[model samples]
Target: MFLQNNEIRDLLNQVADLLEIRDDNPFRVRAYREAARVIEQMTEPVASLVKANKDLSQYRGIGRDLAAKIREIVETGGLEQLRRLRQELPVSLLDLMQVPSLGPKKTAQLYKHLGVASLEDLERAARRGQIADLSGFGEKSQQHIIESLGRVKKSGEKRLLWSDAAVHARALEEYLMDIEGVRRVRVAGSFRRGEETVGDLDVLVTCGRDREKDVMEAFVSFEGVKNILSHGKTKSSVILRPGLQVDLRIVAQVSYGAALHYFTGSRAHNIAVRKLAQDKGYKINEYGVYQGEKRVAGKTEKEVYASVGLTYIPPELRENMGEIQAAADNRLPALLKRSDIRGDLHCHTRRTDGHGSLEEMAHGAIAMGYQYLAVTEHSQKVAMAGGLNEKQVLQYMKKIDAINEKFSGFRLLKGMEVDILADGRLDLADSVLAQLDLVVCSVHYQQRMDEKKQTERIIRAMDNPYCHILGHPTARLINTRDPMEIDLEKIILAAKDRGVILELNAQPDRLDLPSSYCKMAAESGVRIAVSTDAHSVENLELMENGIAAARRGWLTRNDVVNTRSLSELLRLLRRP
Candidate 1:
């Protein structure tokens, strides 16, 4: 198993806690804590160095004794001191430490006296009139734990984006790679697509017999592990670092493809595949697909799909989005590649409320290989948000011209996130809007308007020659707010006739226009613009989410506006 600085650090945190509770050596505890800090930031995977028998003593803050212990942890599943501490203190006592608000000291105090184990039991004891009687855990401390548990429960089901998952997955990969005889390992599912919210984590690994048990032990003992959700020979789940649940599954070399296919999913897609397998007189599971007489699909995913007379689906398109039909019919749309995007049309900067300066924003876009960037700051109506008033808008335009002047490559278009007022009028003056390179009209206020009013506002905005794109048309945040009611058909038709593009806002929280509407937008001859209504440098990465959402609508690159080059975009903008 390979251990990363973070994984080692996490393990040290647990060890440090156990030592403190056992009243063990203070310097030893400090050593573990310091070691963890050094390991957490170590760029290279630790297991590789261990396999090569490299000198770990060179690692900063790693002394002779600590390096030996790290070697012991890498080789054996457990350390002698850590095992002794565990024997002295119940493993269940770690549950108290798992609560968000409880620190190691508070956890030790609770365990030393009250004999609390799990959070549920602690809550019961606290509420049943026993906590106040304890020495350090007065009403305030008790209340804090209860509140923390409640908050944890409420926020539990939320998913993490792929970007966040990579951090955790890389840590686990490093820890597991250190184990002997383990081969390739990779992360699959929504994390691969870079989706913002991840439901469960799936890691695929290949290993030999001796390594499996050792790997499982090390995996279960991972510093981030809060609870052993479940463990088995082929698979195991552990709640690591808060409510984030990670599930790891191991496979023999042959079954790797089958296992990955089974895990990477939209449940609907899997079910469809299973039905196909049934028709072909075979059974498919995480292990391998079997015919009544023999095993067929265990070695590779392509083989698994080929058994069903279909092409293997790409991970991004494994959402049952007519993939099965396309596979059977051999008509799957070639999904858009990252390189298809020519420019980023809707972005924010410090000239408005964005975190980075205009130059920084453009440089970031350029760094992402964008040929052009539309610097669309907020219009004057949103005054509270440092919106660009008339003078500020002109001054910013001049600044943008200066920026374009200094920069040799890539065009920066002057634009604004103009508001669609309650009266179905754009907030910016027509003459003022005409002076800009592009305009994106969106709804900021009046989200509560009736469907007729909202539809009319959107339609009226689309009719304007200056309005290049209708940003996040319905103003809905997935799983949070209901899409504002609108006559989408009528509005889409208007946009089509007016040659206006409807934006699929790439912000994770607001993948607006919904996938269904985007399909309709595409059919209406109204091009769709997948733009990251980015407020910061980091926000530009939200384009993946936009692409994912667009995929759900069966969008092709040609149907998207931003896929057009600057000349093409200008040509479309010049349409009557």
Candidate 2:
């Protein structure tokens, strides 16, 4: 089996943990760790090289000894040394290293001194105060460890949602752009492509040399800056909020666009272009491309694209997702626009788990230039979140009516995020569903079913007339969880046939109908509803990711639900 990058990284970490316990070659351990980091940054699947019997040594940091062993494992499915290590120490011991506060050395110490093998056992020992009594485990550390363990239960997924990242990025940009001497700034990397969790935040800025120093100083002094990792005239790295690394690079005003294009990329996009340039007898580097001693493209990104014989690819389309192919064919998809969105159909208020009030949410949508807004509060099944029962739903609708009466210019549509129960039934009764202006059916539980069952369950839910849109279908949290087991092709087709809209959930963390799936849905003639699924006024802005992801799938304004005017949207909703 081809190992995923995560699997390889996990194994390397396990090796490091084993090395720490044995006090083996420190350099060997360091090599494995470095190799893991390098592999993590590699865009191409490394396991394919292993499977193909390609030289693993070709990758940087993978020296001969390690490369041979990697190939051996690929050929035999196990490393002799790793197996021996597992025999001496239970492989389950590796789980201790995954705790938030614990690293390899700490895990080794725990295994050696406290006999802790897993987070569960560690938590049990800590709660009983046994951990506090151990050598090196002080009371404060023990308390902190216990709290970290408690946090494990609350860990829904490992990564942040992509929509959330964009929201944070925009907020950061707005904050930075207004600062003195700070010129243009753009968020780069997977976050730009709308990936849920980003490893780091890459911001590119261009300013004259006179203002560069102060801009750098201001960034490092920003409120969210916890620590400055590096600071220079042109580039700086800082640990921002929640310990996320924010790397800001400054470029000359002339090269601002080129630098933004280079920095704001999925590594795959950069690599593909670099290789293309190489094949064309040009050297493409961070500064610019050169043909021998001559500078061919350096002033702007547009020139760089022009040098490569293609139109400038938008940062959003820099995923190597047919951009090169389209460039080769001299064709680029007409990306979706903000104007294509007519209204947001799923929003929440303080009546549920939302931060804003109903009136505030509606007005926020209006401020976004939306023609209509749907207040989709949680259903009664999610009682913990102040979900609405049938009576509460009716009351909320009445409140919406009163709000609509008072608020003009934008229409307020009453809706409910009806929970898709474990057995595939919507939380609300048919009567309650029928009473709503629109129903967003979503799987709120039992997301771990087998593929066949999940597909059948979702298809059954799609059959419900009140189910106008399937919310966050597959229930993926971007980089964290795998998209749930539903057969997406079947789900898309069924939704299309039933006149059900597949939601392009803009919650960044759950851009559930991904660009790839959205493209497929579009090709299948399935209508898409791009929704923010916003729980707060600020979150209403997440519709941008929805628009971007849809564009990646080649969706235009007309292909998206909200792109329609209120009358057009209502006409489509009125069908079947």
How close is every model to the real structure, measured as TM-score? 0.70, 0.68
lDDT of 1 by residue, 1-576 (tens): 444344555566779888877667888887787676556435465666777898988864679888888778777645787788778888766656545546566667777677776677778877876777777667765765676567656755655544345668777888788778889787777765444467767888899876787777888999768789888876888997535688887888888888888878767888999999999899998778899857787788898899888987777677776779988998877766677988888998766666568887888898888888999998878886678777788888898999898776689988989988888788878888989999999998867567888888788777777888888888876433457778888888888888888898877667776777887888677789899987666567768778877876778998887889888888877758
Q: Please report, as a residue range, the 10-residue window in candidate 1 with the lowest summed lDDT.
A: 1-10
Best by TM-score: 1
Off by over 4 Å in 2: 1-183, 210-223, 391-399, 478-482
RMSD of each: 11.3, 17.4
> Which residue pairs come into collision in candidate 2?
161-508, 161-509, 162-196, 162-508, 163-508, 340-563, 342-562
The RMSD (Cα, Å) of candidate 2 is 17.4
lDDT of each: 0.77, 0.77
